[model samples]
Target: MRSLLMVSAGVAMLGLTAPAAAQNMPAPMHMMPHDGTLLTVVAEGRTTRTPDLATIRAGVTTQAATAAEALAQNSTRMERVLAALRRAGVAERDIQTASIQLNPQYRYQENEPPVITGYQAVNMVSVRFRDVAKSGSILDVLVREGANNINGPSLSLDDPAAALDEARRDAVARAAARAQLYASAAGLSVDRIVSISETMEGAGPQPPMMVSARAQSESADTAIVPGEQDVTVTLTFRFLLK
Candidate 1:
């Protein structure tokens, strides 16, 4: 019995000492040193290409005394617009109704409750024109049929792979140029590139700087300029300093 008691006491002491030993152990090592010097740099690149695709939004609106009448009128005008789109070689899938809303019109009165005047229904459709060259004629036809609301002929590149490749090449060149500049300023030389990361920012028609699209409200024939699109790429690179 005395031998068993001594064994139990030794086991208890070992358990207590194990916890204390673990608490005194150092933490695991990290891959990078805390005092290591690193450089952070950003490089930007842009490429311009003519847009090949055009997107537009068109629709009709109607107002009547009753909601049913307003809706019917809106539906008729929208049907006519769709028909016009079909006639212009726009496929069924390319034409889609984007918005349809019906709300009651209100009239304000001095020191009195608001009164309902009429119900207005608005229907908007988004159309994609693969052939951007003939967009003017299409707009004319849509307006003649009953379309009153037209948004834009937003242009874009159909295949942006070539432009993206150009942008990436430029980005790398920019990164290298910046690294060299920093190295020269610090009286060092860039030995090797340790890591490279890239992010794509924008790939669409460039914003209008001097010229804007003419509004359809003033004229039936819409003039579109398939201007240049800007594709941009940004990159970050880590270079080893020597």
Candidate 2:
């Protein structure tokens, strides 16, 4: 009987401890629903700025009865042009030889093989000018120094980061404004930003201006107009709906 009483007391003690342990256990977590609605919108922003740098292509074209004569004349003329550019403040690093070519000139007669008349030689160089205002005077000097073939005054900005940043800000603002408009129309509120992405489009240096060679008397300072260039950015934004 005493042994039976001890076992019964032990069973009662175990039943009391079971409820206490159950009360001390952590509660299960409740997960939020993942089926919320997503709203996305795209917006674009653009900014215009004037170019600050110019690139000019200048060269000499010579024709003579012999290849050696043509090449020699072209070389001498190009040397004078390089000296003039240096005197006008163009650095050696900014001048680069773009092309050198020697070809035979052909004269065609009716019902006969083409006759070689003379040899033509061309030597071209590309020059970068940091000062836009000096481009015209430099071209005049180049023409005076025997640059017969002159083309281009390509204009561009040295740095476009600031303009691009401004465009990005404008894009984000436009996206937010459009999102708010949609949210108000649907009687919903934007709770948070889910994601953002960007696309850069139509942002590059302006097209180059072409200048043809003219007679020395007619060749005044080459007029250069550095027009405005556009910087554009597009943004796609996703906002959570509430």
Candidate 3:
């Protein structure tokens, strides 16, 4: 079916850097849901913000001839890591045990059955840092206290309600702009909005731009650079043109 003046657009994150072309055609009467020309405008709202929180996976891994021995060594190191976290003002609620694993290392032979050589133990926790600026120093302390395996610094906002609301407003504005453009092209004006709805594309914490700190000495330090993440909300607006 032909449209009177169809406007459909896609926007880039952080800003509407690119916009899809708007198409104008002869008005059709059979394919609309209203008396006048029906215009459906789809637009995305986006905002870039520096993350306010960091989630780090810090742990200790140890290998020994037996599972019991490996676990013992890992426990000893993990205690010190916990102590350092508490000393650095990390709240107990922000730290949670992720996993505790013990596996047997096997030596494979060409024709003989596999024989167990040693056992490896790993203890890990998911640590959330509310203060992104100070997380680097805290990570350094964790390293000094015997955290051998560390990863992530998953960046995110503490409370995204405000940012998402901002995006919602942006979407509405974009939809309005596109609708006006459509009305003008079709030799009509925007009468009113027939319907409006939103689609949140799950604008959660961006992927981890991790500064992995692994097997570092006391003299070494870690740094966390919180870049920017895009929070986006997509909206579809149905406007009537008269």
Candidate 4:
């Protein structure tokens, strides 16, 4: 009989301690709002702006009987291209060496062993243009300065944080408006927000465009058309209906 009483007392203590521990635990991100019905809504917000910056890839390819000769020839031409960029007001910090390679050119036959014809060397630099309007003209100069290969004019906003914040605000407003509409339809009032999650959808890159050596954007001039770019934000919101 004494043991039974002691066991009952221990169980009572355990029950008290369990409640206290649960109260001390941190709240979950998606905690229910006092047993109210939850209403979830998803919406998207998009903002459009013209790109203000651009990136271009320019390089030279050289061939020679020896790897050393090919590399030397490539290095000289690449220097000319770099100088042209400098003359065009391109900052040194804006130019980055993307790649340099020397490979043996091989001629393959069906039954015979492959023969090494010559060595080819390639050097490339990635250049950023702060002013997209002048980028095309500068590219023409690069081609004239012995850049044999060119690709891209990847356009983007210089700073996207402000635009993204605007998008977020739009997303929140859209989600709340949608949830409120649902609450009204169900004859319930929106009590509080349970949770919110967001996804950023940035603009996609432009297709890769290539220009041969000395080729210009147009006759006697070059033009860069920066079409409108869209930045999107998607949000899911959970609200409690009282």
Candidate 5:
């Protein structure tokens, strides 16, 4: 009986010691340091290329004493313009009607409130030309077909993904070089890249080149110059200092 009691007392003591030992043990450590030196740098890169595609905005405007007359004249001219585009191999899907409007023409005089001079009708369409080389000739055809109010020949790349990727690579390389230079200047070394973020600028379609009414009326084909467009990217890099 005494040995049984002694064994029970020893088990109770062991249980108490186990809990105390567990409480005194150290906590698990975190993998990342709580306080570390970080360096941030921003860099920009650009790539230039001649645009491959062109978007043209063409329209016809007509004025008549009556609204019906104005609309009829405008429609007749617009149909011819559309037919010319179709003959030039511009796909139906590539042609979109931008706007059609009929507004009353008003003559404002200082002495009089307002005077209704006539009615004006306008029809506009946006055309996308996959073959940029032929865009000038096409514009001439449009003008011949009675497209009086013509604008644009906006230049752009059909696929900007490749250019954007190249810009990104350039941006990252520039960022790394800058970071290294700054780290060395601070008497430190770049251990690793903690984070990186990028922003794209000037990657959308470039401003459209304007075509004058006189230029459209000229006998020669419109002179279309697809200038080089710049694709730019900016990168922000966060690097760990060692």
Candidate 6:
């Protein structure tokens, strides 16, 4: 009889302690409902400024009876162009050979066979000028120094890291402000930020000079105008519902 009474008391104690343990621990997944709505908010910020760097593609094209002759002529003209660029205050490191090609020119006819006229050689170089005021003058010098083809003079930002950092900060601040507004409207307080993701879209490069315009130059100096470039950042935020 005593053993039976002790067993009953032990079972009673376990029953009381079980409820306390369950209260302290999280409930099982089956007892909970997955009906809570998730809210996502996004914010965007932008900054604009005029580009400071100028990128130009200048090259020399040469035609001769033989491929070797054409290449040699192209090389000489390219050397002269590089020398002129250096004299115009463009650094050696800033100038790079973008392309070099040597191909035989063929004449096409209606019923006759194709004939090889001469070998055509091309040497292209890409140049970056930090000084925008001298961009036109540099092109003028390049043209006089044997640059036959001017493919582009696309302008861009030289140091965008600082601007991008500012834009990111602005985006985060905007996201937080929007999140708070939504949380207040829904009769809930934003407890904490769950996650944040950001996307940055860079500005488009400036327009390139037309090939036709490049081939025919009546003026002594080429004119270039660089406008403002826009930098934007978009941020997505997820906040815990309180």
Best model number under lDDT: 3
Could you give candidate 3's per-residue lDDT for residues 1-242 as a string of tens digits?
Answer: 21233456542111111121112322242434434556778889988788998998999999999999999999999999999999999999999999999999999989999999999999999999999988888888888888888878788888889889999999999889988876776678898886777898646666765444453454455567887888899987778677
| Backbone clashes counted, model 5 | 0
Among residues 3 or more apart in sequence or in different chains, the pairs in candidate 3 whose N, CA or C atoms overlap within 3 Å are none
Report clashes for each candidate as comma-separated counts: 0, 0, 0, 0, 0, 0
TM-score of each: 0.78, 0.78, 0.84, 0.83, 0.83, 0.78
lDDT tens readout by residue for model 6, 1-242: 00000011112111223334335324463432232223356677788878888888889999999999999999998999999999998988899989999999999999999999999999998999898878887787777788888876788888888778878888888767866766566666666665677888775467666543354355576666777788788877655445
lDDT of 2: 0.74
Query: Worst lDDT window (10 residues) for model 3?
Result: 12-21
Off by over 4 Å in 2: 1-33, 215-219
**Residue 97 displacement (Å), model 3:** 1.1
Give a tens-digit lDDT track for model 5, residues 113-230: 8989899999999999998888988999899889998889788888888998999999889878876776676566777876677899877778887886668778587767777999
Q: What lDDT tens digits, residue by residue, belong to model 2 across residues 1-242?
A: 00000011112111223223234322221221133334556678888888888888899999999999999999999999999999999999999999999999999999999999999999999999999887887888888889989878887778888988999999888777866766676666766776677898656656676687784327566667777888899876666555
Per-residue lDDT of candidate 1, residues 209-232 (tens digit):
221223444565666778677889
Report, for every candidate in turn, its global Cα lDDT versus the true structure.
0.70, 0.74, 0.78, 0.75, 0.77, 0.71
Off by over 4 Å in 4: 1-30, 203-208, 217-219
Sliding window of 10 residues with minimal summed lDDT for model 6: 1-10
lDDT per residue, candidate 4, 1-242, as tens digits?
00000011112111223233235423452453445455556778878878888888999999999999999999999999999999999999999999988899999999999999999999999998999999988888887778888888888888888888888888888877876776676677788876778888875555646655555634466677888888889887767666
For model 5 the local lDDT of residue 227 reads 77
> How much does candidate 3 score in TM-score?
0.84
Better of 2 and 6 by lDDT: 2
Enumerate residue pairs that collide in model 6.
none
